[model samples]
Target: MPGLSPRPEAAAFLRRWREALIGACVAVLGLYWVIFSFGLMIWIGWAVAAAGVVLGVAGIQRARFRAGSDGPGVVRVLEGRIAYMGPLDGGTADLETLRALRLDPTGLPAHWILDRPDQPPLAIPVTAQGADALFDAFASLPGMRTEHMLRSLNAPGGASVIVWRAADPAQKRLH
Candidate 1:
């Protein structure tokens, strides 16, 4: 034991490529099954391969999200409700009651503006403590794309973005 020093090379390697490793493993397993098996096995392989590709793409997005900076407030989500408490402003929005979701980064601070019927809009900074969770919350909306939201979130400031909009025409659109 005195002459041996523990090596973390394997751990380091995995830490860097964990998602890609999983994706490759899934893809290889799927290909192996499809090539070596038949009938139902091939269908199963296709499922695995599809999942592998989806996971690989998600991994890349996740990496980009991890690079996002922590913004200027605390964001809390509960039972389809969201609340933002910041130094300059704070408000709450119910996901169930949400009529529209817009992003305005052109301002001094980027904001996720939630619009609800008969209620004032609520704006939460993009860098809020729990903003990352909004990625999933926003996705729950009909036809919301997590990847698109993430991309818009990381885009350079200057223009606003519409992350989600209800089918109801009453929903507001911020130009």
Candidate 2:
């Protein structure tokens, strides 16, 4: 009942995805109209536009369902452990409260890797403008310990990783 709410990050992702879908739909509609007026290849253009609209709607519906699902984000924390959700290939991971912080400077688009044994490392893409805020957030975690540096994956500029040890293991477990 509790672990089933939408997180702020997820909401933001949905918002951006919606905007992109709308833009794509508009473009597809314009193309459909142009092709219709030309009187050549009208059917093909209509099909393509229809497919685009269907796919866009499906994606939005999927995101909405995910946002409403009963999952890890629904829980409330008072004075126990704190867990942050991160995307995994198959499911999701509840990152440790705060263990260690590592910053790497090798990847081009730059990324922050948060390390924790309880969950897989969270690799967050970073921009120059967001680096300071990200660092501050990590530093502000309730109980963080060791930090480390890792190798980059051939990105252009550089990258960084941050590790934190969670204070409450119970609350940090992945749902």
lDDT of each: 0.77, 0.46
Cα lDDT tens digits, model 1, 36-72, are 9999999999899888877777665655554233568
Global lDDT of model 2: 0.46
TM-score, each model? Answer: 0.65, 0.28
lDDT of 2 by residue, 17-97 (tens): 773477477558857676656665666567666677777765543333222232222221223332333233222233334
Tell me the lDDT of model 2 at 40.
Answer: 54
Q: Model 2 Cα displacement at 94 (Å)?
A: 6.6
Question: What's the distance in Å from true for residue 78, model 2?
Answer: 14
Runs with alpha carbons beyond 4 Å of true place in candidate 1 = 1-25, 28-47, 62-69, 145-148, 169-175
Clashes of each: 1, 29
Prediction 1 global C-alpha lDDT = 0.77
Candidate topping lDDT:
1
Cα RMSD of all models vs. native, in order, equals 6.1, 17.3
